[model samples]
Target: MLDYSLDISAVERDLALPDLVAEGEELDALVSAEADWTQPTPAQGWTIAHQIAHLAAADANALIAIRTPEAFDTVLKQREAAGPHSADLEADAGAAKPRSVLLEQWREGRTELAAALRDIPLDRPFPWFGSDVTATLTVALRLMETWAHGQDIYDTLGVPHPPTTRLRHVASLGVAGIPLSFYAAQLPIPTVPFRVELTGPEGQTWVWGPEDAEQQVQGPALDFCLRVTQRRPLSDTALQATGADARKWLEIARVFL
Candidate 1:
């Protein structure tokens, strides 16, 4: 799935770019197959069109953020001034467009964003919604969003989304997002560290944190990814937690900001 060795200890653009392309291409195929874009997805209030629109808009925003930090700040200001539901508004606006037009925009934006990420310097931080991040985290976020949103489309279409090693990126991001998940849910971050051991698609083991940590999470990699992305309910996954903090983290896990 990756050109070099898969070292998700830090997700560089090389690893994320191909995975991003794979995820986008998969969703693109599903949406392109349907003549009707008005079909509703599992995401409440979001249609199939809404899903693609959101990805397109997000990719466009990421492109600007990577290429020109100053320009991205203006975009951020506009989103802020638009208020809390601004993201929904952006999706709504794009969803209003013709399906063919929206598809073209999505493809173009994705291509451009991937290209920009390939050359971006990893040292500089750029403005995101309320924070700044470098290209490394930026590309990983793009991949995670693409895969997570693609899941909604897949479910709506009754198509199976086979797990791939590309998910290593999403899994890593999900694990790293433990703190953010707690913060988002208004829960205090746990002081104790967690050991996460997931069985990958090919039956390989992917582990994070101290192996001897008392609080632990063990499960299939796909299940962990689905849980953290909130695509699948915790009750439905094969994941197991050994302590209070580990269990609570699964309840509110989220990979996106």
Candidate 2:
């Protein structure tokens, strides 16, 4: 009956900073010349521009959710009125803008997000995907989102996935989502817990789950992120899972809200 939510303990002051920098600069570089905005990305039916626009949309939304709840409510209402494909509508609208304009929007949005995150109190609850969570937690969640979407953009263009210490943030989110993942899959929550040991990019080992549990997953931190986000097939990675519960979690792992 214990809550398995991962304790960040230390919120990387400006958790989204590095990933934001990397993502923006990389995308900037990708379009340095007369680039192809229409190039397809890993996200189904979305082009590279759509991918970045979605991130921009998310960044702006995060800012609203963190600093202006009323504005966030308006957004939720607009999306509700627009119906199920509202997300697509938003992204497409963003993507439809001139490439230069769209890029500026993403850049400016992230810049403001950085400032908003700096002053946001940790204890203040904000409406996230389905429930209210603290601003500190939302930072890590945003970092994970930025990183995961970066994957789709890179994989779409055959670029190598960016490796960074920031991944510990995402790996933590993934490990924390095991219960929710099970709940969404309509599967029984595992009565027996498991352990997760990921060797991060900086050679730091990240540990999660219950230490004494019989089930365990261990491998490179990047692979852990890939699996949790379903950005890549497990068969393509080197993560090793021991015990039925651990293996099943890997087969159906997902952490996004």
Whose lDDT is greatest here?
1
Scored by lDDT, model 2 comes in at 0.78
Tens digits of per-residue lDDT for model 1 on 55-137? 99999998888787789878978988999888889989999999999999999999998888887776777777767776777
lDDT of 1: 0.85
TM-score of each model, paired residue for residue: 0.94, 0.89
Candidates in order: C-alpha RMSD to true structure: 3.7, 2.7
Q: What is the lDDT of residue 86 in candidate 1?
A: 82
lDDT of each: 0.85, 0.78
Which prediction has the highest TM-score against the true structure? 1
Q: Model 1: which ten-residue window has the lowest total lDDT?
A: 1-10
- For model 1, the superposed segments whose C-alpha errors exceed 4 Å read 1-9
In candidate 2, what are the lDDT values of residues 55-94, reduced to their tens digit? 8998888888888786787887887799878878888989
RMSD of 1: 3.7
